[model samples]
Target: MKEICIVEFPSNLGLKEPQPGKEPGVKKLPDWLWKHNLHKAISHNILRLDPPKYSNSKDVETQILNANSLVEYAREQAYLINNLLTQNKFPFILGGDCSILLGTAIALKQKGNYGLFYLDGHTDFMNISLSETGGVGGMAASIVTGNGHEKLTNILNLSPYIKEENLWCVGNREYDDEYENEIRNSSATYLSLHELRKQGISNSVKSFLQEVETKNLDGFWLHIDVDVLNDSIMPCVDSRTPDGLTYNEFNELTSYLFQGNKLSGLEITILDPDLDTTGEYTKNFVTNLTSTFNTFKNTIN
Candidate 1:
């Protein structure tokens, strides 16, 4: 439906800097995606941004690693996205982690309130105290919805980057006792993996879209954490959960989403190329992604 431009962020501050001697594969995603000719296969025009400087420092108060750097980086990212949208181009953001969703949401919030379609293995709704690692990635969804540290929630003095009713979280398979309570109390609509299977993927998505339509919002952002795929096929994530969608299922869901013109942009996150030693996963990912985009193009025409 719209011309696509790939945006790459090679920083991993959101997930915390890679431990010494261990590579943070998420930071290398841009290179891996480009190596596999993702740009060539998906779109003719590609835009690459310089990666933000890596920082391992943490805020003593919030226990969020690289909090300062993350704020600055998200601000810069929002600027870039705003510029792209002003040009009337759809951005396909290749992220370092789900924290990039903060930048995208800020950009959209500047224009108006918009919806979010989050597809991830984990709900990412943990608060600072409950989060095991205190990484922003784990708390990104909560932070964007104005539930976390003030520094993140009040970015640019705009809190609650997205409205609760406009947010739809899907494919989340991991949740603990506290998180379950959080979800129950949260205003955001959540579709767990179990419910998604029971209701059927197509029906689940259609139902979400129906709610989105009723909201009468500007548009929505699509976020995909690769861990949403089956662990057997995609084990490259930092945390792996059991029972995810098959490649065919992912493609079908993506194609259905793309068929709609309401999507303002899309972001793909949590893909660690370092784990794919054989490159089979990357190959399969590229194939599915390309096919999905092509399906969208066909629908638009």
Candidate 2:
């Protein structure tokens, strides 16, 4: 067992608010407000990394022209993370969005092959050609898998930062049929909520573990997005889905993953406090998450 540490990231995609839908429309907030308020609101349990603001923060352009700026940003964060990983600390990150996974994942690639226990509602495998929507969040996973956007793919000087064969997506329930098929074809594995409900968390955990052990993976990483939880439990996500994992179910899964002790890193993404109503979502989010880390800490210590 290893110690778990949190690394904070500050990034607000400066877009506009999305239209109401489960396939989330993009929403933009003032970057400064997001950094000062929303980013500040995340828990302080883990090591906090300083947020990066580029010279172009004030300039206006698509995330494309600014891709170089992002690459620079990724490099800096990657350096900090690689240094820490060498010290044998488990790196957990609070994200601007799931895209932050690219930088952190890149930093750990040198550790040899690792598995991804990806939890998300959307497949995020679309490229410029496949994406019906132009939102970067929708394409972030594909980007990390070396599917789209050179600026993103080139960041931290790595391509296909995560191996698709070792990546498994769990709890994703909402998706277009075409995209669902795409996930089936991709190197990744998809375990939906229906499967989870039918098979039970322990059974699902056992299934994932059996595959990993049989394949002989070097390590595993857990990437969690709040959207994986039901809209009833986590409504502050970028997009809210009506049906998903319950709190007890998600916590049970979390405890099992922690207890497994094969985790190389943990990354929590897609928390939007602005989208939250009474902060109940944020409270539960942090409380459930921190309690998880605490339990892991106690066991390891």
Candidate 3:
């Protein structure tokens, strides 16, 4: 375990404009979490990688919105993350959107072979044609796994930031056949919400860890999309669905993952404060996350 570095990537450039003239509020996620004191018990070392200006127009070349800017931001982000890794700091990144995984993935690839623990409501394994809004955030899993346009899939000449076999896509509640097939057809392991419950949360986590050790991977990264929580509990995210992981389930899963420290770091993404008109959702989120995080605080300190 090492000291934690809280990196704020407040960029909504990866999502489509929710409204005609309005941008997604995901960029405010880090601040909202901070406003609720998510950092109170967590580390105080914070860094902000502000994104380039957000745009509504999709790139004609890639047909993904803000493709060029996203690549640029990811490179800068990798620079910061590289520094944190060099300092032996565990990066607890607060993201603007799931697409932030691009930067994190690139950063990890620079070091060595790493695995990905993708926890999200949707598979996010979409390509431009499959994405209705052309939001890169929606295709995060695909890009990181080198399944999308070369521009995003290839960063620093490190295509496939994470090898498919070393990846685990979990907590997907979206029942889209095409989306599910994207990851399912790949070598990456997929565990839908239903499958996770059926097999038991702890069992699912243990299985992933077993694979991590088996591969002798340098380390692995955790990407958590708040939408993985039950819609009844976490409805502030852009894509809301029905039943998902409960608070207790989330805590139990993370507690297991954080044990023994093979994990490189973790990131939280796609929680929209605008949708949570009342801060209740954000507050509850902060409470649960910080509580879970604090359990491992001593090891890092």
Q: Rate the local accuracy (lDDT) of all candidates.
A: 0.82, 0.65, 0.89
lDDT of 1 at 130: 84
> Which residue ranges in model 1 land beyond 4 Å of their true spot?
21-23, 298-301
- List, residue by residue over 164-255, the lDDT tens digit for candidate 3: 78889999988878878888899999999999999999889989888889889988899999999999999998988999989999999988
Best by lDDT: 3
Q: Residue 66 in candidate 1 has what lDDT? A: 77
How much is the lDDT of residue 47 in candidate 3? 90
Off by over 4 Å in 3: 299-301
lDDT of 2 by residue, 39-140 (tens): 344334455444444222222333332345455656777887787678887776666666566667678676667778887876666665564434455666
lDDT score for residue 72 of model 2: 62
Per-residue lDDT for 45 in model 2? 41
TM-score of each: 0.95, 0.81, 0.98
- Sort every candidate by TM-score, greatest first: 3, 1, 2
Alpha-carbon lDDT of model 1: 0.82
Question: Relative to the unseen true structure, what is the C-alpha lDDT of residue 62 in candidate 1, on a scale of 0 to 100?
Answer: 77
lDDT for 160 in candidate 3 is: 90
How displaced is residue 199 in candidate 1, in Å?
1.1
